[model samples]
Target: MDTEAHVTERDRSSDPDTREGEGSRSARFLDAPWRRPALLGTACAAFLLLFSTFVMQPFLIPSGSMEPTLRVGDRVLVNKLAYRFDSVPQRGDVVVFDGTGSFVREEPAGNPVTGLVRWAAAAVGLAEPAETDYIKRVVGVGGDRVVCCDKRGRVEVNGRAVDETYLYPGDVPSRVPFDIVVPQGTLWVMGDHRSHSRDSRDHLGEPGGGMVPVGKVVGRADWIGWPVGRWSSLERPDAFGRVTAPGPVGSHG
Candidate 1:
């Protein structure tokens, strides 16, 4: 009788339903209220990271290079898809590009943690731009003759004057004299604050002659997204009005 009683107890404990009930209770504990929010927060963070890295990213103004148009500390939205569909950047468009082999001294560096934080900040439109990133106006597109001080000290593109009224007050179109015809699939960019900026003109003696390859261009700056009082849509300057469309590679004034 004792043996039979012991066996009956053991069988009851070994039942599949009994085991399943304990598993269900364990699962409920593991999925407590806090777990949901934690998981959700993680998912949200990952989505934002992906979006900022691969899609549109917000960049903050860190220097006076693009001043008057983009002030220090102002945030701007960089449209990554703008160039993905289109093959070239247009005149008067503000562009951001990787300065790896083109302009900046060196490629930017960041560890995993720092990168994550920066990405989060940029996603929220608060972080400053990366060190190796550059923002400038496209003065000459592929196959355009961009010469400085065209008799009246104005930059000329395809034999037409570019009215740079948006340039910083007291800033000339270019203080450094340069005369170069942009090659096909390349761009010549300059800053509005010509005196304060180190643009393509700065690297005229360097490799590639300060010209940014079309492949390196990131996107156009379409709007200023932060600092509500300074918010405004970026308009294409009407300065290129009389400029002719790009013709043969070497044909220009």
Candidate 2:
């Protein structure tokens, strides 16, 4: 009698209705209107965070420094893999870079946790760009001589004058004159609006000679991703075609 009683209790506990009832209750709990949507939203955010971190990043233009090339409120899509494989930054290519030692003295101190969140937010174009981030056109590359204002008041690279039609209207190539050779593995960058930009020319007196190390480059600005009216690619200027590579033969090799 005792054995029969125990078996009857065990069978009741293992009933399909009992197990299914527990599972259904759990499912209902998870299916709360807010909870399901919240879960999906979190999954989407995580995907964007990863994609923006390693693939491409949307950088917001904070000011008019880039002017005609990149206007205020423009979200430039930085191609992170542009130079990741075997390529290097070339003259006339607009690039986004971290200017820690080149532009800013040092990185700002911040809590690591907060900083990570802020950086992730900026990566996906959800927040403002970091203060140390900068975007500019490559005027001179490694081993090239960069000079401001030739006889025609145009910037010169490798002894050839560059016709900058992209310059902000009425804005000169550079208001402050400078002449320097770009260091190997570094880049001399400038903004389209030379008058208002504080670019490599502005940092000529400081260390690195206003040159941004190629290693600091985040990526080339491939396209304008935001503002439906301003959707277009940032093409490399043909003016650089005339300028030869630093070495002999006047070739791109």
Scored by TM-score, the top model is 2
What TM-score does each of the candidates earn? 0.85, 0.88
Stretches > 4 Å off in candidate 2: 1-21, 248-253
| C-alpha lDDT score of every prediction, in listed order | 0.83, 0.89
Q: lDDT tens string, model 2, 1-253? A: 4656444346654889988998898899898789989999999998988888788899989989999888998998999999987899999999999999999999999899999888888988878889899999999988898787788898888788999999999999988888788888999999999889999988888988899999999999999989989999999989889998776533422
**lDDT of model number 2:** 0.89
List clash counts for every candidate, in order: 0, 0
